[model samples]
Target: MRRKLAAGNWKMNGLVDDLSEIKALTEAHPDPDVDMLICAPATLIAQMAWARGTHALQIGGQTCHAERSGAHTGDISAPMLRDAGASHVLVGHSERRTDHGETDADVAGQAAAAHAAGLVAVICIGETLDQRESGHALTVITDQLRGSLPPGATAANTVIAYEPVWAIGTGKVPTTEQIGEVHGTLRATLRDLMKQAEGVRLLYGGSVKGSNAGEIFAVADVDGALVGGASLKAADFSPIVSALENA
Candidate 1:
């Protein structure tokens, strides 16, 4: 069976003081079949490790450098992330793609780095508002799938997250049919692209909340979630996990 993962991207959010929230979330969330993870900012990775081990929740990094090490002054290499105790890392998030002008190749390189360091690469892909409005959402998304993943990407080494640009943080969500169409396309793309991979996890990440998580997860190909704001609070995120468990 495909393992369902619920990962939180604390994206530029969280401080040393915010560790308490992670503590609270871990304390409130009991063992569920779904995988629970937190991708905090780089500065807090080491500290998050302690919180994760204590709470028994998974720890991850928001991003990592393409290179394993060396003169990349501001870069945090994957090996370094691993040393910091991060078992997973997010790549190709829309914010990184847009704001940082990261190309699909950049994401692929990052994925390769993550794999080399024995970390799961939560590779992200999505279409812009214009692409969706222009009815090219599937095409855009599939194209991203093709380019964002590295050649040796096995299901074990990677995770796919579809976070539509318009929906993320906009309090909007794709229709069930729309979500199915995209996720189904992503699954087929993975099957073709990574012919030997086993059980690649496909997660939805656009405005996912407790109220709508069940319905969103009902889509045929969705295996998990890459939650944002909702993940910061246990009250909101706990039910979403319950929804997945009950499903």
Candidate 2:
């Protein structure tokens, strides 16, 4: 069975003082039933890992370069993230796609690099409001799943997060039925495309918070969530972690 995961993306946020949040989170959920992870900015990764030492909480990086080492000035490579005590990394997030013009091939390459560095790649794929309105959400997501995932991707080295672009940080969310449809479709697509699809975890993102986490977790095929704003604090994120544990 796939283990549930509660992942938080601090996303260009968090400072050295914010390491206290990780401590508070670990104190609140010392022995959580589901996996817990916090992906912070590269600057905080090593410190978060050090702060969460001996705790069940995992630390990760927000993104990584496709190459191991190169001339990319500000880009952190997968191996560098792994060395910084990160066991996982986020790839293909909408922000990167929109802000940096990252393509599916680029995402796939990054995932491959993460795998090479023994880091689990949290690959994200989602459709925009226009695509959803035009009835192309499924097609867009399927194409992304096909193109963004590398050949060697497995349950061990990869996880998928579905985050609708319009809903991210917008307090908008897809209906429960819509979420179920998309997750079910993703599961089927994975089953058809990979040998170990059953063990691959599917996480729902976009406007996920403690208030609505339980309901979202109740949806079929939703293993957990990739939270944004709510995850910045232990008080806000602890309840969502508890909800997933109960689910």
Candidate 3:
């Protein structure tokens, strides 16, 4: 069975002082049944890692460069993230795709780099509201998945997060049936494309929170969530973790 994960993306947020939230999170779920992670900003990664201390709460980076090093002024490479105590890094987040024009091939290269550096890559793929309304959501999502995943990707080093672009940070969510449809298609696609597909975890994102987490967790093939705004606080996130644990 795939292990449930409650992963948070702090995005461009978090600071040294924000590490106290991690303390509270680890305290709340000292022996959590599910895996917990927080991907903070580049500036606070090392400090967040230090703050987590001996707790099982994992630390990660929001995004990483495809190349290992050199010339990219503001880009953090996967190896650099690993050096700073990050065991995982997000690739192909929607914000990066829109704000930086990150193509699927570019995301694939980034995921490959993360794997080479021995960090798990939380590869994200999703469609827009327009695509869903036009009856092309499945095709768009499948095509993105096919193009964004690297040849070296495996269940152990890769996790897939499906976050619809229109729903992220907008207090909107796809119905549970909508989530199930996408995740089911993703699982089927992975089975045809990889050797260890069944073991790979599929996480639903976009407007995920404590209030709706239990219902979301009950969806088939929804192994966990890639939470956004609600993940910023322990009180908000802990119940989601608990819901996953109970699920």
Candidate 3 TM-score over all chains jointly? 0.99
* Ranking 2 against 3 by lDDT, winner: 2
Worst 10 residues of 2 by lDDT: 53-62
Tens-place lDDT per residue, model 1, 107-214, is 999999999999999999999999999999999999998999997798788999999999999998999999999988988888788775448989999999989999
C-alpha RMSD of each candidate structure in angstroms: 1.2, 0.6, 0.6
lDDT of each structure?
0.88, 0.95, 0.94
| Of 1 and 2, the candidate ranking higher by TM-score | 2
lDDT, candidate 3, 99-162, per-residue tens = 9999999999999999999999999999999999999999999999999999988999999999
Give the clashing pairs for model 1.
none
Candidate 2 off by > 4 Å = none
After superposing all C-alphas onto the true structure, candidate 1 shows an RMSD in angstroms of 1.2
lDDT for position 150 in model 3? 97
Q: Would you give me the overall lDDT of model 1? A: 0.88
